[model samples]
Target: MTLNLENEQNHELPSDCEETARQVIRQVLASENCPYEAEVNLTFVDNDEIHRLNREFRQIDRATDVLSFPMTDWESPANYSCLEDDETAAGSFNPETGELLLGDIVISVERANEQAKEYGHSLKREISFLIAHSMLHLLGYDHMVPEEAAVMEQKQEAILQALGITRDPEVRS
Candidate 1:
């Protein structure tokens, strides 16, 4: 559950914001009923970097939002292989780093700022939500179906609430 965050940006954001993001992601992982520890590489980049990545990796021409690169594609439990070593990736545990490989999540800080303004929330909250959402995707959770979407969304809200990240909540005076 260790997050090796590589902040590849010069944009200004609150100090400890990355740690807050790490905490939220860890919270979700701890509550998740799964096996194997996965290492999450969160890269904070600008819009251009994300856009280029979006085009190269996803074959899209635009960078709309967050992108998730899952380690494997075990969509169904019948074909599930969590108990075994993943064929799609290097071993979850790396001796050099002593961390599980959970794939990567690239986020656009520039876009996150715009989203915060559009959504009427602080930038911290918006970025935190995106991190949480991407973490779920890393854990094989998705919102492709209505039922599955509800469960995933519920988990997201619960994590955010658990972190006490709310809209305009009174801070200690």
Candidate 2:
């Protein structure tokens, strides 16, 4: 797996945040039992930039913590598969790595920081959660309905727990 990360914001994010995000992505993919070698592009942006993206892509004017643009379409988790030979899939692959391009994840660093404070967790934890959530989106998970949201949430929590990324006890109360 390769994570192509770009920092488009002015914020001085911690140097290790990129590496941490990569680890989180790896964990998510592994937990989902994804078979294909994959590549994901991650961009870190400020509130204003993310707001612009949200408006352009989703027609929402507010900045969001994360947005995922998946390259492939799968109906459900049970039927997840990556077809390397398909023309649609082939067009996205990296020739050198032969990794299937999973698509992009855009994260607003400002929103993430605010969410971490609001949710009483560390910035790393919040970012990790965002990455995990986005990875699931790339793998055909959606939270549009109650049942779908429940499943997605369960997968996110399980991936985080497997990574030993539990919320702090002090933060829970």
Pairs of residues clashing in candidate 1: 39-100
Please provide, for model 1 over 47-161, each residue's C-alpha lDDT reduced to its tens digit, 9 standing for 90 to 100: 8888899899878988755888866565552123653644543554566765556678888888988888777788788788888898888777888889988988898899999
lDDT of 2 by residue, 1-173 (tens): 88899999886665578888888888888888777788999999999999998999999989899999988766565244446447656666788988977889999989988888788887778888999999899888999999999999999999889887777735321
TM-score of candidate 1 to 2 decimals: 0.84
**Residue 170 C-alpha lDDT in model 2:** 52
- The backbone clash count of each candidate, in order, is 1, 0
TM-score of each prediction: 0.84, 0.90
